[model samples]
Target: MRRSRDVPLLVERARAGDPRAVARLITLVESGDDLLPQVAAALAPYAGQAQVVGLTGSPGVGKSTTTNELVRALRSRGHRVGVLAIDPSSPFTGGAILGDRVRMQDHATDPGVYIRSMSSRGHLGGLSAATPQAVRVLEGAGCDVVLVETVGVGQAEVEVASLADTTLVLLAPGMGDAIQAVKAGILEIADVFVVNKADRDGADATVRDIQGNIALSERGPGEWRPQVVRTVAARGEGIDDLAAALDKHRGWLVEHDELRRRREARAAAEVEAIALGALRARIGSLRDGTELPALAARVAGGSLDPYAAAAELLAQLGA
Candidate 1:
């Protein structure tokens, strides 16, 4: 049951620029539910209003710093921005922030910028399950731009790209073994490859490596040729150009009907996510879930086979 009877009111107030209402709305979305119809209806009016950017990279690659600079850059352009920084520590209890505060630094107090830290929350699918919902909430709140920063959880890559309008894979210069560092999935879907810390050694090589990676990434006719942008976020270098690249891509997408395609794709993925999440939830609700523990005990005693148990669960779900 939803703990908030005033969710709709909160949603309305948030849209009216009420910061407290916005904060409360963030909490509601951060803790997601199977209420997709409500979520979709609430989000219909704001669709196409926010450009969601997913910023992900290896740990210590300054993804947070780059994201902060990007947010500042966008804000200077008079755009409202919302950030949901996904941290790895929340995977267990859905409450970890890792270095979000340390990374975001000073943006928390900005009224135009809303930033929230999310934990991985032990999701089986890698990215936080509530992440997509958070995106919708931010969009509904009228942010012109929204950023989702992943937990840097290795190469699981998860489904961030599927939820975002654009995905940026940030790489720092001199973070060596360039040839062996490209992650697939989300990395392959990058609309912009950012070589941050571009003033550092090996920056040139990193740029080349990223360019090569983009060359290998999927491309369609004039496929919005993904650009390899070099930025020294610490010094605010290339910030405007990167922003320009983002705009250029957006314009190209709008020109080619790819923007609509991407949103349709996201909507499809959202449906799939809801179906899968519901299936998992239903299985979890079976017999109060004691079926799993008892079955595990039986397997431990060698009285049953784990594979067979899984088959039974699938059969129960009509899979």
Candidate 2:
């Protein structure tokens, strides 16, 4: 285990925009190693400053292209950017598929950009369990914006909304009909609807379909209405408009105090996840020792109800 004193030097290097130090710090968080608490303690003062943006859609909707272009756009404005691209894990090897990383190599030479691809490791909801923590590392490393691109699973990808300050649901024309889009349930989680490949045919219809659906949704006065932005990301068109819309959303979040509320909710979820992880570790320690298997046998034989067995386990943990 590393002492708390040993983490500050890495943290300081990361704060000074040393990519190797930032990568090392994030690697520790992602590995869930014993040094995590000390790293978190070192990073505690520097996080909560980056704007987290999430991008999700079905596969082949140009998510990688958009992310690449978006990074360029942000960089053009002198903002340091970090990208956490969640890729589906290879079941045999437990490694990332690396397709997204390959596409994002345009930024490989830029000192201000850091791009990391993480395997989802069979976690549902299109994100890795370590994603939020990795975002904290990037935030502490002084990224102005951290863009999280999900694994591109259709409906389950909505989890990003809870983790991101703003969620962009990307759509490409002719990928599927508008009804198919609604069935994915992406509408409910979208803070912005991006119609990519806008130079293609039917892009206008796609835009109109989204606009109509959003208009039908019920809302009160002063609600933050999601804007539809069209982009040909490959050609760098409409990116400026998309960036402006991001700024507008940021302002709206601050003006309405939504940022504070969202951060509070995010923090609460992080605490809950950590507590659950600790409980799981404690349970694992008891599994083969004495309590768990005995309880299981009793329940299996109908001598003890499952609820009672669970109560016993909880009592042991609490004790």
Candidate 3:
């Protein structure tokens, strides 16, 4: 356990761009330890400086490759980048199962870029519960841009939309049916769409399909429409265009005042989740054949409805 007294020092060091200190602070967040509140408080003032960009897609869509190229492009423009690559968890060790750390080794020698791979820990939304806090740590560390690359599990990964200032949905040609993208609800969340591996056959077809889908979806007047860009990430082709699209989206967010609104909603959701987690922990303390089972039994017997039983449990907890 990190001493609570060390939190201020960590936050200061992180703000000075000490990668080690930044990493340690993120570890404390991920551990959900007693030190987290102190760390959050210390970092709060320096947070929210970085632009968060989320990259998500189904598995095998080359998200790691795209992230590497995106980092390269952003760095060339003199942006200090931070990457949070969420990888699937190893069941035994609860550590990252994927080799994103290896894949992003291109930036390993660059002081201007910081990359961290985190295990999803069986989280269903393609991100670990600790991701938002880790992002705040990166922002406080003076990263100009923070790229959140999700675990890329299908469907549930849509949660990334709420977490990023701009969400890029990556799709590769022939990887799957184009309709699957719609089914995954990616269309609703995407601020920009990247047809990666554009050198491949059927790339144009994939782009067309996405364009057709966007046309079918209704849009409000003055709403920022999602733009599509093509990229061959491995070859570094079309990356400049993708970067331009991101800039355009950021400008639109600012112009429409959507930036403030989105961030407020994000904070609200984070607070609610945290409060629910604390409540769940308090309930867990009574799991030794206490109130929960008695309530369950009553509900099972039909003498008490589930909603009424839930009310009883909340009252027992003084909710």
TM-score of each: 0.83, 0.93, 0.92
Candidate that would win on lDDT: 3
Candidate 1, 1-319: lDDT as tens digits: 3644556676788788787876666666666654445755676677778888878777667777788899999999999999987766534523334554666766877788888776666664356777777777777778899988874455434467777777777778767643375555645667888888988899998888777766776677776677888899888889898899888887877888988998998888878877987888888876577777777788899999999988877777788
Q: Tens digit of lDDT per residue, candidate 2, span 1-319?
A: 2565658898888899899988888788888888887888877786678999988876667888899999999999999999998776645322333655677999999999999987677677657778888998999889999999875565446678889999998898997553374554666678898899999998988898889988988767877888899999989899999999899999999999999999899889988998888889998999978899999999999999999999999899895
Residue 133, model 3: lDDT of 95
- Tens-place lDDT digits, model 3, residues 1-319: 3578878888888889898998898889988888888888887886678889999876667788899999999999999999998776645322333555677899998988989877777777558889999999998989999999875556445777889999998899987564474564777899999999999998988888889989988899998788999999989999999999999999999999999999999999999999999999877876775788988888899889999988887888899
**Candidate 3 stretches greater than 4 Å from native:** 90-97, 176-178, 181-184, 289-309
- Cα RMSD (angstroms) for every candidate in the order listed: 3.9, 2.3, 2.6
What's the residue-level lDDT of 139 in candidate 1? Answer: 75
Better of 1 and 3 by lDDT: 3
**lDDT (0 to 1) per candidate:** 0.75, 0.84, 0.85
Decreasing TM-score order of the candidates: 2, 3, 1
Model 3 CA lDDT for position 142: 90
Candidate 3 at 115: error in angstroms? Answer: 0.9
